[model samples]
Target: MKGFSMYIGGISIKNKIFISNILIIVVFISTQSYFANTISQKAIIEKEINNSSRELVLIQNNLQTLVSTIEDYSKILASDYRLQNELYNDLLLNTKHEDSKPVGGLNNLSMKKTLSETISNIVEPNTKIKAVSILTSNHHWVDVGFADNAYASRIFGDGYGPEDRYYLPVWTSLIKFGFLYEGEDSVFAVSKTVIHKDTGKMIGRIFLYVKETTIASIYEEGENKGGDFYIVDSAGRIISSQNKAKLYRDFKEAVSISLPETGKDTTFTQGSGSEEMLIFTHRFEPLKWTIVSAIPMKNISSGRKEINQLILGVGAACLLLALIVSFLLSRSITRHIFQLAKTMRQIRSGQMQVRSPYQSKDEIGYLSEGFNNLMDRMEALMAENVEKQRTKAEIEFKLLQSQVKPHFLYNTVETIISLIKLGLGKQAIQAAQYMANFYKISLSKGDDIIPIGEEMRLTESYLEIQQLRYVEYMEYTMEIDHDIMSYSIPKLTLQPIVENAIYHGLKLKKEKGIIRISGRRNGNQLEIEIYDNGAGMHKNQIKAIMDGTSVPDEINGFGIRSVSNRIRMLYGERYGLQVESEYGVYTKIIVVLPLRYH
Candidate 1:
């Protein structure tokens, strides 16, 4: 009986041991799976945020580039106005000489050759003539290129009726505008007034032909740089395109597409009947035209695929690592270790409230609970440090603000004295009055935010003083949006920008240069830009200004660095000075700030 009882007890003990082992294995597997999933999800979320932020930055850069190109084209077109006016005047001055010609003059050949040579020099190279005719004031037309059978055939067409020749709307418009036709074509024609050179009396028209292809070629050469380019006229018709026929046949359809309402960069997808493309449209205000550049969407996205793949690969590796770690540590002790590790990771990632799972009185559990208490104390200390830093920044900003006004006043008074010595009494008196008004609002009894109008007046006072001192070497202009002038901005915000432009940009130039001060409202933000058409800095100089690494002792333009620091101190790092320069052309400094205090 004793032997049988012992055997039963042994069986019961073995069963209990086997069941405990199995339970431990099950717990380990479940914990491992949870750990792997958490790691993979965290990595994916981080990658997504990083990629999204990078994409936003790239898009913003591209938009700015597009806007800059449009502005450049507008400036180029504006410079062409004088050339167009000159051409118009030349036509009106030559009206009398053609009328003096005899009906069958013997010297007609010599006169035609001389006139052709003179007009050819004025026109651009590679120009072709289709028809040269003299039109009388009474509406009679005389064909000057009668000897050229091809020209006569195209124009006369075996008769003198309108149907015999091509009807040119441009030519008709020119004639109505008091131009004497010298040539006619489907695209453009040239005409001069029919006045005798000696008598200067209106006689008849001297017509010269212009090749439309020549002007089109000029514009094409100017705009082409490997991308698809097209020009849309003021009326929104696709007048010319890199692929002529593709756009020509669908002119009405293309015209109906909405352009960017403002002078902003915009992107659109355009195509029909197997001709799809991505179009980037930039407005050229001076020409009253839109320059559209198109690229294949597939091509642009193909480059992005590699970056996408890289991100995916990194994500996959992290997920695989998490899975392996979770599977390997499936025991109960390992589960506790993983939980503790996760809690530590959360604390490191700034979640201070996280705590380890510990419910036992064993050594491991005691250590975990003690670690959690330590983390709580550390978090409290960190919070105190953050508050201290905030207070310090506020105090430093106030000190900088206090220093700026006194310095500005002393400089203004010195400038006034100099103006008085230069025999400019009335100007000095006016400047002093402006100085008083400027300081009244600038001080505002230590107010941090002041009206933008007050800032503008303060800037104008500084500019006025500088202009007086460097009258022969400097010019200044201001453009402020009326609506935005009432918005408040940081005090002494613009002085450093003006100082930088004059000292760094203009002072280096040998000849007198221009400085432009402009402002505009962008949503809830106020943008103030100071640009100088003077000797610009190199890329290295601009880089040093932005990074704040360049020392003031090394260069004379320390004011730029000061302004940048003050802006950062007041508004945070996101709002500050942005400097851009092209060697020998211009330098621009932009200061961005919120319209109202946060």
Candidate 2:
């Protein structure tokens, strides 16, 4: 220990500090990892198993409610007095008229029309319902929905016994085992037998049908949980499953496992090695359905493993972090000297802007300040100062765009949702795509500069989405020269100006407002003007904005100040924004740039 202490003391203080911190961090982290792994491993596994079971139960309840709701709807339809009367008459008519085309007579047509209207009403409210059918005891059918009646006809035909009227067989009857849903869709059916209470006579059967997606949606979360879900009957037949190829197969065939005769809802492990599965089962006893989840046991243990690995990873990270922190600590003790040395090294490598940011009243601070002043004068002489200014403008413009983005995005999302609700789905999708493009180009993967063409496209997309919400009152036109389209410009230059025109100008107009953007190049400079025919500002308002004496409220200038400052700062004081307007007549904003927009 004495020899080691002498060795540490002999080295430089920076190395000594670095070594000491590393040893301390290693010791502390090793102890923490030991306790964390030993104490929390089993607890994490147990808690995770319980959480998985709870999630399974929650998903099972959703399925239970869905099936029960469909059955209840079937019940309501079966008990419909008019529907029953129509079916009973149809039954008698089929038995009398040979059941060949029941729509031949006026009375039959009227009965069929009534049944169609009733079934349409039922299907309208529930988008998931693919079809609803009514079949008399004699196999006469009235079907309403998009699906072909051929499958329902074959499933609900006369070959079945009395048990077929229940929900389990009704679902199973339509499924073909080992047939993947990709080959043909699975149409799940729920049957309820119709009968007259007073007459004590069987009239017909009402069947409610939906695509497998409707049932799969109930357990969609389970599907994403690195597992598969199945609805099994008491007979152990797999009636509904996410991997539809296994539908209607025995549970044993899908995953063979031994079970206790407890007839209980349980979670247990099955199989060996990679074939192992963590099985979760919950019974829907009312309909004799068991919702089963077969997840890989590996998934169950992954949490425990990740926690153990995470602790070890944290230990490794801390060891690395300690070295960096110790080095920084030694340098901080003589920060002025260290920073001045670093700045000198960076300037040697041609980084002129690398000035020591440290300032103080000490002698070392004066030395750094003198060094920084020398570099500043040298930077200006070298003509590299413009690059520094351009970088500053880039950062400020990026911030400006980020600040205004959320407000515009929030408004756009509402418009998209409204379009969807109004059943203008195509328009909604188009608007959403336009919104994506607007942000995509405006952001451009952290690039503050973009082509003028890209900026125009971004502006157009923004306008399209805004027009979606105000089609009656707003429109825009762009007349930009193709030659200057490839010119480099700062991002978000024109959009904010147009946005200001719409919000502060056009929105206040009593009539429809038009926004026109025209661009032209003058020598080495490019000029773009945004004109809006609406409530224009007065001379005083424009002065307050240009003089920077306007109200500090965000909505007042409508973001024009930020755009103006950014332009002048990037190009020069000669370039920026100029406003012209007459109150209640029109507003126009002319933007000057050296072919760059910010």
Output the number of the TM-score-best candidate.
Answer: 2
Residue-wise C-alpha lDDT for candidate 1, range 1-598, written one tens digit per residue:
8998887576633344444555554466556555655555455434433443343334334434533443333233222333223222433433434566423331256644543444343333422343344444433344333223344345433333442132221222111111234433333333444433444444434344433343345345442223455556565566556565544333447544455667665666666534555556666554455656665544444444565565556556655564454445344455565578789999887688888877678776887888888887887887787667557645645554565567657877887898789988898887787778777767788786788888898889778867866888899999999888887777777876777678777888998999999999878677899999888889997887666677655223455665666667666777888888898889988888876732
TM-score of each candidate structure, all chains considered together: 0.38, 0.43
Give Cα-based local distance difference scores for all models.
Answer: 0.58, 0.75
Please give the lDDT score at residue 540 for candidate 2: 91
On a 0 to 100 scale, what is the lDDT of residue 147 in model 2? 38
| lDDT of candidate 2 over 1-598, digit per residue (tens) | 9999987778865566666777787888888888887678567656766876887778767877776677677877878888777766666766687746644221456665887777886673554566676667666555444434565566556444676445332444335211122335666677777886557567777767666667777887553348777877778777777777787777786768554446688878788888887777777776767777777866766667778777878877887777778778866656667678888998997787888998888887888889889988988876775676567656656666667788888998999899899999999999999999998897798786788999999999989988888888889999999888988887888887887788888899989999999999999898899999989988998998777786656644636777787778766788988789999999988888885434
Off by over 4 Å in 2: 1-35, 92-108, 124-127, 143-149, 164-184, 222-224, 256-261, 271-276, 304-306, 313-598
Checking candidate 2 for backbone clashes, the offending pairs are 489-596, 489-597, 490-597
Model 1 has an lDDT value of 0.58
What TM-score does candidate 1 get on C-alpha atoms? 0.38
For model 2, state the Cα shift of residue 565 in Å: 99
Report residue 180 deviation for candidate 2 (angstroms): 20
Off by over 4 Å in 1: 1-407, 554-559, 569-571, 595-598
